[model samples]
Target: MGSPDPNGRQLDGLGGGISSLSKICVVGPPTRPGVDVEFTFVQVGVKNSDIDYSGNCGNLSSAVGPFAVDSGIFRPLKDSGDVSVRIFNTNTGKVIESTFPVCDGEAVAQGDFAIDGVAGTASKVKLDFMNPGGSKTGGMLPTGNVVDCMDGIRATCVDVGNPSVFVSAEELGIDGTILPDETQNMPRLLERLESIRQKATMMMGMADSPEEVPASIPKICFVSQRNSHMLLSGERLEADSVDVVVRAISVGQPHKALPITTSLSLAVAAKIPGSIVHQHARSGVENKEELVIGHPSGKLVVGAKLDDNGEVERATVYRTARRLMDGIAYWK
Candidate 1:
């Protein structure tokens, strides 16, 4: 193993190939009945020295509940139940609570549930997005419009749990579900999406320019008719294709599994009037509380409760989070 970088170059011994690895942690108390969130994302990649705390990791977000429960950030319940962690994200000034399944008075990790990009099955991790929209730009539609055309792609830019730019699969010459190899083969298509994302970020007011931006939040996704099984990195999701095409971007690439927050954003965008997502979504009434979003891995069920004024009252979903390991990561 390499020695830890004196200038904070290496992060926990993992090669910081991507620009998203620079970070430090200091957990503290929440103003409410949960673990308070206080963490910062630093610049790892020399190319882009900007850290964005506006968005939480949909992947790493799963581990927050377990981290809190086991670390005594919160007292574990006496029975298998929910443990909530109030995330005080530095980037967006937002507090999000991620809930997980606790079994035997300990956080649960074993189950038949599976998420793409991860091997094997684990317990379900659920995240309750408290006012998920506008985590970053202060509005669900950052552009002040539900839908817009960027780089020749019509998209619905909504900030739910995370900022997302939603488009249809057909625009990208896809049916919404393509094999990983097939997608990898289309480097040109991927490159085009990058351009779209860069512009969308500016429209969302996340960056002044795309020159040195790190492709993180305000992810780009495509939607299409749900497939009975969508093959991702060679894995198959056994759910039928939903009405609209759904694809989401994460960390500058197509997320192996759809982001939970982005899923919420998609659900919200699909509801708003004049939004492109609303025009092509599968059979469901507008502002429906429960909407199942079909992803490349499996179908993620999202519930959106709307207020009488037609604004989203609250959006909820079921997910399982487990701690993989807790040890000092050595870097050089």
Candidate 2:
């Protein structure tokens, strides 16, 4: 990136000035048993030339299966219908099963499905994060508590698809529904979120000191009960349509849209009895079900499967992907 803007504007490179867009994925023939493709996810810095591989991008992970089939790393399971591709994400050491529609022995790429953040419609790819608990750290609840207080902050340190520190935006003197500029431009507010995130990583044993903690993994989210929210783009979110409001900090700024991997953690956190997400999330969430997440971009629905003990069995979400300019571009 070589660009330095607190707003995450990567003027010097290919980054889209956001965390969701500054990414790279390398897929190859699987080396493990029962896996079709193996991948390592790279998160390029939006403001600098640094890259971190400590986590996975759920949005980009959706494209791995189609990439494998199109690249000849895998083949269609049948002549038609749906083909499921097993992926091993090296970053998290977790296996994800991606099911894509098949047509004439090739992965389908066109359909009527659409998602927030990205424009246009494409073929629906169902990504099921198999046993998605504890992508980093160790157990699902790394701190061994659904809710814990640290530095006078009430937060939940859970590890589902990724490790994240979930805190109440109200505790931080905000409602958790503001837009990127409104919150990202405030140094004090951004500091508070980063401080909580560093503390969370330390508390979860992912890092010994705050300085050692990276900004990508162990993501941070400021949440509040559903309310009227005005986006930075001048859009309004009524109360009834959304169960909760979320303002997630990605890399260093407010995420234009919530990260797909973070949504897995959020779904599991919402299912927990006392996590911050559960406190504000709507009730009647059954095991192996879906949780609708409200973010700055729009609403995203995620699937969660919990055991009888309420442990995260799996987390799933639907996404769309297309191969744009597949040929490589040389960079100096």
Candidate 3:
């Protein structure tokens, strides 16, 4: 994943030179009952050409319905209006229920809902992930603790949507508003954050060694008090509009936009007592279903239905989906 071009470009590969652009979602017919389809998401490294399937992606998952309808890879469903694609993520072994708007048994691509980072708007996809806790290590709080101190850095190791190590930005001398390029320019900080992630990975029982842990299993992020921040595109955000400003590191860089899975994990962690993300969470989260998480690019609202015992029964979020193309590319 290291060999970028002279201008730090993924010029030699199909990758778009960013962490979010190098992903492959392969859909297959369902092998399990009560499921509409099976999807295996692959993260292709920009320069190394390596693939990691340790977790699922919410962005690519949005396109599954349209892909299934156009390719006829789903099934013989005899329904209309809204169709549910019960996706079994092979990497995390979890079920993602994606409901998309369809017209005449085909996915409709016209809608008014819009998501930041994407150029245009399209039909909205409602994704509800069931039993999302402990996506990797089989427990919500992997260390059985909320906050842990490691190498002078405090972090919360949780695995709701994915195994993530959440650290307060103040602890790392950061404000959680910097963009991805700053992360790529600083090696020592990334190393430290990764060290925390690897330690949490082992504590969560996802790996015996941090160095041996898979590239994409346990993600990392820095949290700070909600503040008026600026996005990479030079758009300014108001502090009152978000609950918390988060800088999530994905594939060793700051995410241009928030990962929906991370938002779900943060929402779940916010409900729990004494987690890092919970410390600065917005008020009224106990009574509210959705939470607004401020990211570097923008903000995303995530909702988690909690049972009486505070367990996340199901998590829901809205995302816009669009088809880039509808053909196969021949590879040599």
Candidate 4:
């Protein structure tokens, strides 16, 4: 991928000039026992030379299994059926189990499963993050408190799939359903959120100072009670369809859709009493039921299971993936 392009567009390389599109996943043979493959998630800056390996990308995690199979790094036992690939993420030191259909030793690429941001339908990749808590920090509550006061507002800092900060949308004086472009117009709000994020990063022991904070880790998001809203696609999102509303910022930019890692954090936060997310989330959520999260793109259903000791056992989410192309390119 291209970098150091001050113009923001990676015209000389494969980067799409955005944080979500400018990601790289490196997969290979596992170095640990009981794991089929090992991978590293890299977040490359479009206009800078920053190569961040501090956190895992939940969306890209879906493709690592299929890539391993297609690239001959991992082989399935069956010829045409569902196959499971155990992956170890070096960035988060976590294991993600990827299960999907494979036909004749090749991962299936076509199906009817669909996701919010992507168009049409494709094969469903089930990603199960085992023992997901404390992805970056040493504990679920890095601050040693359910809620922390930062920037004169209450926030919940959780470290499930990744370290994340959740604040009330009303406290930010903004609509929870605000679109990405509209958020881009609010410089002051963005600045305030960044300040809180920097403080949270230090509190989570991820960085020593504001300048030392990585661009990707400790994602900050706003939460609100379920309410009818309009999505980026101009379609109506009914309040009853979702349990909570969220707007996330990634790499200092408003995300058009909620990051899968952030979604996992939210699911865990909602279960913690006195947290900002728990306060605003819908009440009477069943223990075994999946959580429906409303975002700028649409809704996503995520499941989080907690053990008897109140520790996160695992988090599950489904996504679709397809290999766009396969080839080699020369870079100057």
In the range 1-332, model 3's lDDT, one tens digit per residue, is 33343444666555677768878898988899988888899887765656888888888888876788767887437545778888888888889898887777778789888887777778889999898987877888888888888778888887777788889888898757888888778899999988888887887888887667877767798988778878877999888998877888888777888777888888888887778888877766656778888886687889998788666788998887766676655444
Q: List the candidates ranked by TM-score, beginning with the highest.
A: 4, 2, 3, 1
Q: Please tell me which model should have the higher TM-score, number 2 or number 3.
A: 2
Judging by lDDT against the true structure, name the best candidate: 4
Whole-model Cα lDDT of every candidate shown, in order: 0.65, 0.83, 0.80, 0.92
Global CA lDDT of candidate 3, please?
Answer: 0.80
Runs of candidate 3 with Cα error greater than 4 angstroms are 1-8, 75-80
Which lDDT value does model 3 have at 324? 65
Clashes of each: 27, 0, 0, 0
Backbone clashes in model 4: 0
Candidate 1 — which residues are off by over 4 angstroms?
1-12, 15-26, 31-37, 40-54, 76-81, 101-105, 111-120, 227-230, 233-243, 285-287
**Per-residue accuracy of model 4 over 1-332 as CA lDDT, tens digit each:** 88878998998899988899899998899999999999999999988989999999999999999999999999899979999999999999999999999999999999999898789999999999999999989799999999999989899999999999999999989898899999989999999999999999999899999999999988999999999989999999999999899999999889999899999999988888788988988896535358899999999999999988989999999998878899896778
Candidate No. with top TM-score: 4
How far residue 57's Cα lies from its native spot in candidate 3, in Å, is 0.8
**At residue 237, what lDDT does model 1 achieve?**
58
Per-candidate TM-score against the hidden true structure: 0.80, 0.94, 0.93, 0.98
Cα deviation of 76, candidate 2, in Å: 1.4
